[model samples]
Target: MTDQPAVPTDDPTVLTDRDLEVLAEQLGREPRGVVGIAARCVCGRPLVVRTAPRLPDGTPFPTTYYLTHPGAVAAASRLEAQGVMREMTERLGEDEELAAAYRRAHEHYLARRAELGQVEEIDGISAGGMPTRVKCIHVLMGHALAAGSGVNPLGDEALALVRDQWRPDRCSC
Candidate 1:
């Protein structure tokens, strides 16, 4: 990994018209239930967005922090293709310290989402297979970017693993 620290997390910021445009471009579709820009690129572009617990279409969306940057998404996908998730999940089973930390991450995610609103359908659920397995690196990366380091051990690990491919300290957008 580079000596530079990963991009620091930012508090949720009010969404602007330009932010919506950028998000749409990054996602290749209209973003749904976005409440605020949770993390940004070095150049001030949106990298992660905070979504509402319940969407307008009546869907109980569980993914609170959504990764929008195309470069970061691709990097996470590459890690998944390389079976990083499976490896991490295995490590979680063998590492008690890591498993406990991951459980805390799951609680953190739930507490944060509770502030938005309650959605019974996904009540105890956090993204990226938290507290159990590594299902989606993209979700973990997004959580790391939005929640900052140390909150999500596995998320932080995934972020570090993909540093060579994508780093929030630099803008690829």
Candidate 2:
């Protein structure tokens, strides 16, 4: 992994017009409930988006941090196809320390989401299949990028694997 720039967690609270346009281009649809930017690429492109707990239609959305960068998403998909999530989940079961840390990550995610707003439907649930299994690398990496390093072990691992393809140090914008 390369020496990447630190992802400042203190991001913009609201998405700008350009942010929305770029996000739409990246996602292939209009982004819904995007409350803030959780992380960005070195070129200042939006990488991770923090969503609202509930949508305008009153649907409870659980995924707080959404990964948007195409390169990073593609890389994470490659790892997922390689069964990285399964292996990481197995590792979580074997390593108590890692599991504990992951649980904390889950807690941190919940707390952060709580700061935005609380939807009782998703009170303690954290996104990206946290605290139990390694489900989605996109979720994990988004959480890692948004929360910074040393927060999500599996996320960190996924990020390390994708560094060659998409590192936060260099902007692909």
Candidate 3:
């Protein structure tokens, strides 16, 4: 039989700004920034290109801007689910579903964090505690996504209690 072209299974080529914007929309948040892209070969492994800062050698790093692929998203979602599970195990303890959701969200946050690195604090406090450098981006992005998804991580009563104590209007004044 004639040799059929090898089927590609990589993540996909680098994505354009527009592509990133679309992914952001799917995520219900603004695209942070373009870091790099990756392509998955037919074997389904990532061929990554490092974007943004260049390597010392000055050769453009492989694939940074990855084309959006269903497999990639699915893989990300799975990792996120795992992270959520880890958090729940630590915080809530033994929650299968909540932990799963948290893990899923966590995976997404970790990926984004890898790309964005640490962001400046937003001048606020979360129920967990004051923001710290290590997990600042995770907390902020989690809050944003939770708010956007209408899934309040903090119950209404807890929020109200916090609000009463730290009223923005009064606190600033």
Judging by lDDT against the true structure, name the best candidate: 1
Candidate 3 lDDT, tens digit per residue, 30-113?
433335433222332222222332234543322123323333334334434545423423553445554455444444433433
Ranking by lDDT: 1, 2, 3
User: TM per model?
Assistant: 0.94, 0.93, 0.27
lDDT of 2 by residue, 8-33 (tens): 55455556899899999999999998
Q: Encode model 1's per-residue lDDT on 34-84: one tens digit a residue.
A: 998888887777888999999999999999999999999999999999999
Model 2 clash tally, residue pairs: 0
RMSD of 3: 17.0
Q: How many clashes in each candidate? A: 0, 0, 33
Kindly report which residue stretches of model 1 are placed more than 4 angstroms away from their true locations once superposed: 1-13
Clashing pairs in 2: none
Stretches of candidate 2 above 4 Å error?
Answer: 1-6, 12-14
CA-lDDT, candidates in order:
0.88, 0.86, 0.32
Model 3 residue 27 distance off true place after TM-score fit, in angstroms: 30
Per-model C-alpha RMSD: 2.3, 2.1, 17.0
Model 3 per-residue lDDT at 62: 23
Which ranking of candidates, highest TM-score first? 1, 2, 3
